[model samples]
Target: MEMRKEKAALSSQQGLNHSPFHTQEHMRRVPPKEPQVTCRSNTYPKGFYCSWHLQHPTYIPTDFEVYVQHNQRPLEVTRDEVHKNRCHVKFPELFSSFPYRVNVTAVNSLGRASIVFLLVVHYHLHRGLFGPTVKPDPPEKVVAKPVANNARRLEVTWNSPSTWPDVETFPLKYFLRYRPLIRDQWQHVELSDSISHTITDAYAGKEYIIQLAAKDMEIGTWSDWSVAVHSTPWMEEPKPITSTTESDIIPETTPGPPSAAPRVGEPTAACSTLLWSTHLLLACVLLSIM
Candidate 1:
């Protein structure tokens, strides 16, 4: 009987010990992790920093910590309040060979920290991110070369820069500006998100001074203007042409002679010559017939 009682007591002790662990295990379920950082471009540009974004996550971010390391050495340290569960960090010193990491810790009201998730930061320092520095290209050569016969339009071409860091996309936005040779005022044109542009609608054969600059939305900074270029359109002399040439070149033409009477000295040289020749021929015929 004593053995039976002792066995019952042992079983009771075992049950009591198992209940606490079972309840504790059931109560503790890990919360979901925060989202990862994302970028607008795949590659970060040279001499520029990148912005990393961590948006809303499974849990609300009330307080947070960020630690950035380069070559496994801490580079940046920051803390922020949670709003939209988003954070942006700019690393101006990031370069191609620099291997960097970021770890984020999120805390709850109870003061518990979630396991740190690692972030990878990449750069193109020595060699460009994707391709070799696009040949350290000089801004396109703008000679402002003057063309004969006042040239009316400007055609521009540039050598691709030696380094175009990889971004989400390319053929980025280009900015152009110019001033007429005679005017001190400046005129500007924006090529809505394109890398190349042809400037027309300019005075033909006129001397123009122009400038250009470019940037990628994914990239952080705008590239310097290509070498300042100077160009002049070849001046074209006015020429007289037949009606056929006029009709082809000029879309709108007078269907008939002008209704307004010619004023004194207004008759064109052609009209005056035709009138004089007709009178001379009539006088000659009268004399011959006589």
Candidate 2:
């Protein structure tokens, strides 16, 4: 048993040597500042997560190791993959009168700093200075699209954060903000008991960026904004005129013979009488000559 314990300690020391937070060389070395720890559970009662950070910069490569204890028994601390200084610890047993004790150690070539935080679970004389409060995760599955045939309307829809356990019992309110690419200002709306909203005043044909944030209805602060979605309001399309329609608008004219000349009026009766008299006088002169 002593040999096994020795091997386990050796393995843990080796793991620390390979941690990404540590570096061998020190340039502009400074001692680490006091660490601040925050722990919360989006799924309260089931579990909690603890994260820590430094108030001031150390100006050199630093290493951090976190240890957590509940009722004098050690709990497993999982370091965050993306954030080296942050870690998570899950509750093995729920609803305890004892407090969780967290110790954070910061080390560098120059010096080291350490701070311990005590967080109480299941209350009594522990005022919750360092807490396991209920903070929700960001809203998810956010989508934005243009309303069909509505040039000025853009519709946005989202689902509750999946990490939240019971949405119906512990409702969440949402905050939505959207803005067109051409403008720096954003339009915001607060919604409860609804997951969708239609922007009736959006600028037509303008592309917009939309995002959502969430908080529990009765407790905790708002979560971070979800991934942004891009969409543009609908625009009316012009209809094309076909050849048949154009022909109907302008009718064809058929060719026909040229119009006949206007008719001449008959001679007056006075003119006819004058013509007869002249003819009789001409006949008399002809008889006399004979």
Count of clashing residue pairs in every prediction: 25, 0
lDDT of 1: 0.54
Scored by Cα lDDT, where does model 2 land? 0.80
Worst 10 residues of 1 by lDDT: 130-139
CA deviation > 4 Å runs, candidate 1: 1-138, 143-151, 167-170, 192-195, 237-290
TM-score result, candidate 2: 0.62
For lDDT, the strongest prediction is 2
lDDT of 2 by residue, 178-289 (tens): 9999999999999996899999999988899999998866556788889999999988788986767654787778989998664577556787899999999999999999
TM-score of each: 0.35, 0.62
Model 1 C-alpha lDDT per residue in residues 1-290, reported as the tens digit of each score:
99999999999988976898866764553433463443222223433222333344333335555665666677644332554444434444534455445555655553434433334433434433422212222345554444344366666555444455543344455567887788888788766444455566667756778887665533334566777777776566779776675547857766897587667878787998999999999999999999
Alpha carbon lDDT of each predicted model: 0.54, 0.80
lDDT at residue 40 of model 1 (Cα atoms): 28
Give the number of the best model, judged by TM-score.
Answer: 2
